[model samples]
Target: MRKLVIAISMLALAASAAFADPILDRQALMKERGKIVGGISKVVKDEEPFDAAAVLTQLQALQANAEKFDADALFPSGSDTGDTTAAPKIWEDMAGFKAVEDKYLADIKAATAAAPADVDTLKTQFGAIASNCGTCHQTYRVKKG
Candidate 1:
């Protein structure tokens, strides 16, 4: 009976610990997205002329990463466990969330494609993408403690 009691206590403690924090795979995804987007934004705004080929390569790579961030992953189909910065409205209004992602992706693609052509044009398009980040964050993310 004593062995049984100790086993039950251990299981209870383990379960409590596991439930204490929210687990999220989206954090890594967001971090990578920020790095790629931020890099491109900085490069475009500064109008630095490295080798044209190198600039184009970096722009393309950033575009590819932006394209890969699945909308579903941004707002999981399952329980969020309160871990995601994505607002509850994201899940409740799936279409709206997808539309934001679509706009964001389109902005990145256009900006990247244009970067090699004219730095001025790239800056304009990239600015549009950056604006989306602020817009989404304003509406969606809950302020962290």
Candidate 2:
């Protein structure tokens, strides 16, 4: 278990290394996070087979995704413009931004610690973490087109 977490951490860091441009890096991270959620959603929806290990890995990877943010670097000064959908409110209320982010990480950690081995339990835990995504997006993202 420790090895898996360490490996996921290394993969997360290595992936982040590709994004020298903070905007691009942040964007990529968001997409990766979404993809992680989507994979879990598939299992929840029965669109894919549920292996408990796979589900747990998904949650761990999500936690790693959350940890990748160096908020200030990801949302640096004057980054509220250009080819991005970050809401101005991020810069306007960064404390609130970080709080929401912290909440997200905490929820992911809680779900992971639960190590939900059954689909029903996974459903409950998954809902909590998934809701955080919707809540944050509403507050921090600008709808594009």
Candidate 3:
């Protein structure tokens, strides 16, 4: 009976660890970002000189996706991963991580809000958001070894 209990406890712990993986969450976030980008591109291509009204609605949808990409939530308490694209240092350097996250979120928020006036404006705003991806990738993302 004691052996069975130990085995059950170990299984529970392993399941919890699987549920707590940050790498899976990061992958999900990347997938979501791709979906949002696809949606935005579809809108852009369809709306030539750019239908401000339709594009604005699409931008709003993009913002909804952004809400899911919050760094705080991405790196939730107790979440860790051995194979994350995110560096382990992020956990130790909370202030630096938050600063970069704040910059990313703020920039994306503004861009989403400003994206719909015209095609040129949408391009500028989208570029602003893309720049953050590059910035964060350069600083925080670990290349696969």
Off by over 4 Å in 3: 1-20, 41-49, 76-80
**Total clashing pairs in model 2:** 0
Best by TM-score: 2
How high is the CA lDDT of each candidate model?
0.70, 0.89, 0.71
Residue pairs whose backbone atoms clash in candidate 1: none
What are the TM-scores, per candidate, against the unseen true structure?
0.69, 0.84, 0.66
In model 1, where do residues sit more than 4 Å from their true spots?
1-23, 45-51
Relative to the unseen true structure, what is the C-alpha lDDT of residue 3 in candidate 1, on a scale of 0 to 100?
Answer: 100
- Please give the TM-score that candidate 3 achieves against the real structure: 0.66
Alpha carbon deviation, residue 47, candidate 1 (Å): 9.0
Which of the predicted structures, 1 or 2, would earn the higher lDDT when compared with the native? 2
lDDT of 3 by residue, 9-98 (tens): 999999998866566877877887777777667655654446777667766766676666656767875555665677666777767777
* Candidate 2 residue-wise lDDT, 47-98, digit = tens: 9988999999999999999999778999999888889999998998999999
TM-score of 1: 0.69
- lDDT of the structure predicted as candidate 2: 0.89
| Worst-scoring 10-residue span by lDDT in model 2 | 14-23
**Top-lDDT structure, candidate number:** 2
Stretches of candidate 2 off by over 4 Å are: 1-18
